[model samples]
Target: MCAPKGAAALYVRDGLRLEPVVHGGGQEHGVRAGTENVALAVALGAAGLAADDLADGAPARIAALRDELHQRLAAAPPGCVRLNRPERKRLPNTLNVSIDDALGHELRAAAHGIAASTGSACHRGNHTPFDLARSLGALRLSLGRWSTADDIETTADAAIKSATER
Candidate 1:
C-alpha cells in the first residue's frame, strides 16, 4: 500500500502526471476514478507540511543513527552479517542487511522490541534478491522522523543478539 503522504506529495509534485487508465469523473483531479478521498488527502497534506518543517535537519540526524546501527550490526561475529545495500546508494535512513544462514523473518522476530520488517510483510516472506540482495531474508530497518540514537543503539544490540543466537 502506498503511503498517503507520499502518494499525495507525488500527485502534488506532478512528478508524473498520473491519470486513470479507465476514464471517469474529475475525481482525484482525473488522476484516479471515484470520489476523492478528501480526509486522506487532507491528512497527507498535513503530513507533507510536517515533513517540510523537518526537511533541513531530519535526514542528517536519521542518517547518523542509521550509520551507527550499521556499524553495530556489521560488527557481528565474523561472516555472520553483511549489509545488503551500499551505504552511499541508499536512502539516508534505511538499513537493509542479512544475517548469514538465518531467515530474515526469523531474525526480525528474534529482535524483540525492534520494529522492523523482512522485506514487505505483505509478501509474506517472498523476497526478491538481486546481485547482493538477500532475497526475502534481509532485515530491513528504517529510521523514521522520531527515531533516536538510543533507539538505534537498542536495535543494533537486539539485531546482534538475534543474529548471534542462530
Candidate 2:
C-alpha cells in the first residue's frame, strides 16, 4: 500500500487550485474524486486499531530479535553480508541484507523453507531492481505479524550460509 504522505505533500506544496484533467465523480477537496468506499474506510480503521495493539509490545520484541540476527550474521564471515536498513531507523520486524555476490532471485529461489521476498510482490516479474533500492541501493525485506524469533534465526542462518557458499 502506498504511504499517504507523497500525495499530501504534492497538494500542500502545489496549492489546491489545479483543474481536473478528467471529470466523472464529484469533486474531492479540488482533486479528482469518486464515491468513498465505506467498507475500505472501515477496514482501514480496524487496521489502525490492530496496529495500535501491535505497537504495545511488538516493536521491542521484533527489534531485539532483529538486532540479534544482524549481529550474529555480520560476525559470521568476512565480506559476506551488508545490512540494507539502518538498525535504529528501520522497522523492527524488517531485515534487508545484500550479499556481495548473490543475486536476490537466486537466494529467493533457493530459500524454500523460509517465507521471505526479494522485494515487493507487486514488482516481482519486472526484472528490475526494487524501486527503493534503485534509488538508494538496498534490498527490501518485510516481516509481519506471523514472523517469530525462530524464523529470524533460521532465516539469518540460511542467509549467512548461502552467502558464504556462493
Candidate 3:
C-alpha cells in the first residue's frame, strides 16, 4: 500500500478503493461525518496531477542519482558501511546506508550541516530507531524532491568522513 503520490493512479486502476475516512457532509457517504475541506482536496488533486505528469521522467532521473550515490558510498572502506535496502526493490530516491561503526545518535549529531535523518522524523530527538527499522532490523535515509546531485555528494562525503573519524 506504500507508494509515491505519482503511483496513486496505478493503484486506483488496480482496484484499490479509498473510502472516505471522514465525510464532510452528514449522510453523504455514511462514513465519518465532518466538514469537507474543499481547498485541501483541490490542492491534493492538483499535486497528484502534477506528479502524474512528471512520473515518467522522474524515475530515470531518480535512478541515475541513486546509482551515483551508491557508487560513491560503496567506494568507502569495507565494514564501515552497509546499505539497508536492496537496490532493486528500493525507492529510487532512498539510500538507507548504515554507518555500522557509529550509533544512530552519534551519526545524527555528526551530521550537523546536512539535512538528513537517522531514521524517521516522527521519532526525532527520541534517541530511538524508526519503528519500522526496529521491527525489520534496518535503518533508513529517505530522499525527497529537493535532493540534488550536489546534496547527495555532500551528504555521502560528510557521512563517510564522520563514520571514519568516529
Candidate 4:
C-alpha cells in the first residue's frame, strides 16, 4: 500500500518533477494518475495524526536512547571512532558515525537483524565510483517509534564489537 503525501509534501515547487507513474484519467489533482488507495490514505492520515500526537514525548525518549548509544560507542578506543555528522544540528533519532579501519558494509553485514544505511562501499566488487564511499566508513542509524532501549543497546554493542575486531 502507498500514499501520495510522503513524496508530495517534500516539494517546494508549484508542480511535480514529471508525470505520474501510471497514467490514466488524471486523479489526485493530476499529480497521481492511478486510482487512489483509499484505505492506505486513511491509514497514512491516522498514522500522521498519531505521530503528531506523540511528537513531544517521542523525541525526548528517542534522544535519550540515541545519546546513550553514542556514549557507549564513544567509549571505544580513541581515534577508532568518530561521528560522521555534528550532533548539534541533527534529528534526535538519527546518528551518523564513522569507525576507523572498519568498513560500513562489513560492520552492517555482520550486525544481525540491524538495519541502517552504509556510507562506505569498500567491499563493493564492481561498485559505482562515488567520492564519499571511496574513503568513509559511515553508518547511518535511525531509531523510530518502535525502537526500544534494548534495540539501542544491541546496536551499540554490535557496532563497538565490529569496530574493535581485527
Per lDDT, the best of the predicted structures is 1
**Which run of 10 residues does model 1 get worst, by summed lDDT?**
1-10
In the predicted model 4, the residue pairs found to clash are: none
Quote the positional error of residue 61 for candidate 2 in Å: 2.1
Per-residue lDDT of 113-159 in model 3, one digit per residue for the tens?
A: 77665566575566544444332323355555556899778877876
Best by TM-score: 1
- Candidate 1's C-alpha runs over 4 A off are 1-19, 27-32, 50-54, 121-137
Runs of candidate 4 with Cα error greater than 4 angstroms are: 1-32, 49-55, 120-135
Of 2 and 4, which scores higher on lDDT? Answer: 4
Looking at candidate 1, what is the lDDT of residue 147?
A: 88
lDDT of each: 0.75, 0.63, 0.61, 0.71
**Candidate 1 per-residue lDDT over residues 1-166, each given as its tens digit:** 1246434545266456765776877766786567667788677656665566366677778888888888888777666677877758678878888877778888888989998987655666553457443554688999887788889889988888887787
Any idea what lDDT model 4 has? 0.71
Distance from true location, Cα of 6 in model 3, Å: 16
Model 2 per-residue lDDT tens digits across residues 9-102: 2334554477666676765664666765666655554555446646677677777777777777677776566777665787887777766556
Candidate 3 deviates by what RMSD?
5.9
How far residue 102's Cα lies from its native spot in candidate 4, in Å, is 1.3
Model 2 spans with C-alpha error above 4 angstroms: 1-23, 27-32, 119-139
The per-residue C-alpha lDDT of model 2 at residue 120 equals 60
